[model samples]
Target chain A: MQIMVNGTTHEVDVEEDMPLLWVLRDELGITGPKYGCGIAQCGACTVHVDGVAVRSCQLAAGDVDGEVTTIEGLGTPDALHAVQEAWIEHQVAQCGYCQSGQIMAAASFLETNPEPTDDDIDRAMSANLCRCGTYPRIREAVRSAATKLMEA
Target chain B: MKAKTLAVAALIAATATTWAAGETATTTAETEAPSVSVADGLEAWSRIYEVASHPRCSNCHVGESGIPMWSGPSYGKTRPHGMNIAAGESRIGAEFVTCATCHTRSTQGNTVAHAAPRVDMDWQLAPAQADWFGRTSQEICSQLRDPERNGGRTAQDIAEHLDHDLILHWAWDPGGGREPAPYSLQEHIADVMAWGMAGMPCPNG
Candidate 1:
């Protein structure tokens, strides 16, 4: 089982049906990504499969032949990636727990729609639940990050 | 700062009162008494257990990261649920974009913002870990006291949240399709208020 997460390749053993989320959280001890809802209905378990934000909870372990990036790999806490930095500047976290999944979703959404409209954000982020009512803030942070990314 | 504090406090107090009242409404004696008569945490913990386990709460108390989550079915042939809606990350339905698309907020006594059927406060599930799916009341009591696991909410915050949050109260008066928590919102509050006053004990076994 050769898989690269954040540029590190690792061989692991696990059942095929086990979702990638468990592979990250249990097999690899990557706890940054949370399990809000497992059925892929909630974006809390979102991670990158080849740079696209797909609910890792929905993807089985066998689905892991592609490149993966968890929140930990998104960037360092001290020196964040553009999206993370943008999240900080825009104050995206409330519980701060859902930010990882939200960030993953936003980053992936922006990749395809660099200049996303409000509807784009609403559609892209509609899959994630903040529980804290942080939707408005998330929308703003995403736009801010997109601008920052475009500038670079 | 005051407005924010008040808002949070009001949200906390209002929800808590509504939840508590819903749980223990039969106690006219309690209601006739002053509002200062608070409930204990253990008692509240039990009711919270019932509510958290309810579909309203349990549906969202998602398990061990990456595990599959649950969602209600759409309208039509769906027996358990009538709506064809799906709760994406927004918890507000992916394709449908209307606060009223689901349920009106104020008309019903529930937690607003696409609120629940009706209640004294808003409605939703507890934190994932606090979920009571086949779990015991003692287990829930213990979970509420923990910070790291409870989304960093402090014991005081938990007490306040349970006590005042209108959503917490909504569990009792959940419009339909489900049974209300075991106790009335008032009784639930008495238990929670007592729990906080009792040093928020976790029923040390």
Candidate 2:
């Protein structure tokens, strides 16, 4: 089947039940989305499918119904998305294993809630687990990203 | 099909014996139950109740909490579904991560240990009005007989729904090391039909 990932459409031959994370990491060689947990419990495999955040590890390849966007597609190194810029500004990464998913989730959350409160940010980002305990910085980065998005 | 026919025949014989034994009619004056004795209907309903209240069915039949439960012996301890999952008002988890993200639709049987349960139908929680989780048998019986909370479906309609609904079938044949609901699907359907024919009698009535 043909799937578009990060602005590139590629034909992939795989089993129907294979998770999208496997397709992205194994087939397409896009490892931005980490596989913290194969189950949906961990949001380390979060990505945007038509701008809606979904856990790639649990999403079946055949079930993908829209354009896929990983952290690679979220922004370029030269022109980072507001969430990415905020991450650097606030130093939200501790070990950085979960940073890509955190940024992706934050970007998607800010899209629907551009002016989120602290509680809102906490509730939204709570799904993505960070073992390094970088939540304070993650919250600050989300707040900063919301400000940057508003300014733009 | 044969099992259902035999169960219904047995129910009829039981109803006849109860009537012959001078069983006082248990249904209220307004009850729509036919010739079947209230005693027999309630007996049949007891079986249906077993299946309805089991964790396989009631876990998703939640209330306003919008949180489906993960209970039964398989889960070890009765708790809210992990990961703070909420079905929201949509009942399909549309506002956040859709239930389809994990519970994918599939015709194949569930053999994966500890994987999210899968069925041939779209994954979703029962409507809030039909909430049955942690409810008593009497409450579920009343709700099943009432048209409003039961999706405006009469007892016969409810019986047919139990007969053919794929999700309902999942309750009886749930794989993944989960305990199937009590009694076979055919027996459940027969009991439901017999109960409906008996005017959908509630336990109290």
Candidate 3:
């Protein structure tokens, strides 16, 4: 199978039913998307598909056949994305298992909702559970990123 | 005139007592099930209670940032979760102190001066909305059924949501201080479905 991740194309062989998360972590060795829960509950495996954040754990390999982006793909250490910066500014992570998911969810949220209110953030990010209880940071990151992204 | 005033006072007292009784009834109803059969409902009650009372539910159920009285301040505020040292949004702070700096994915319990540090399985914090605590099952049920309110899901979508969505499944995987729900995810869904199928009943009783 041929899959594109973060703009690079890779060819691999695996079960069609294999979860995108497993394929990424095991076959491709793209371990950025961690596996907190095989189910999408933890949002720890959140990644971007064509710019939309999705739970890679719940998505089948056959399902996400397009461009997939993990946390590594989002930005670089030297040139960090605004969301990453905002996450730092807001101190969003606690346990850090769910930060990738929180970041992915925030990124996806900002794409459409460039400027979100508290309620909008709640409704959008509710699906992405942060067990570390970094929700306040998630919201703050979203707000800060929105401002930063809009400025950019 | 005095006799008439006394009569009106007695009527007023009776009305006030009725109002007080009504308030008490609501309080009981709020704590107990909306109906009678829920006595065997301990399992069901606990499942709902766990989900409702868990940090995921309690944190959001409590208060947002900048409230007069914060529910759990151990996380931080200006830092989005304020405390000892703050990480901006990046999890890594201004000095490049990432959330991973202290809060690694796993911990036994990292202690903070003002508040205790989380050290359980993936201990961190539920998002800001977690402050919304002490919700009744029926209220959560209603929230789950409403697409506009419940994360943009429809009635049928809710069934799929429960089936496929994982965080909902986390009630069964609550680690450390938190235990999994008394009932399996399927059973909770079934009860939720029963209510959903019954037109998402809210307790008038």
* DockQ, candidate 3, vs. native dimer: 0.03
What TM-score goes with each of the models?
A: 0.45, 0.80, 0.44
Q: Pairs clashing in candidate 2? A: B33-B198, B33-B199
Model 2 Cα lDDT, one tens digit per residue, B8-50: 4332222221221112221111123346567778888888888
For model 1, residues A1-152, the per-residue Cα lDDT tens digits are 76688889878888765667898899899888898766545668777777766667656576454789989998887878788887887777877878888888788778867887887677667767788888888888888888988998
Residue B189 displacement in candidate 1 (angstroms): 63
Best by DockQ: 2
Worst 10 residues of 2 chain A by lDDT: A119-128
Q: Is candidate 1 or candidate 3 better by TM-score?
A: 1
**Local accuracy of candidate 3 as per-residue lDDT tens digits, A1-152:** 88999889988787755668899999988887888766444567878877766667655565454699999999899988889999888888888877887787778768766877776676556656777777787887888898999999
- DockQ values for all predictions? 0.02, 0.22, 0.03
Error of 3 at B13 (Å): 77
Q: What is the C-alpha RMSD of each candidate to the true structure, in Å?
A: 19.8, 8.6, 17.0
Span of ten consecutive residues with least summed lDDT in model 2 chain B: B20-29
For model 2 the local lDDT of residue A69 reads: 99
TM (chain A) per model = 0.94, 0.99, 0.94
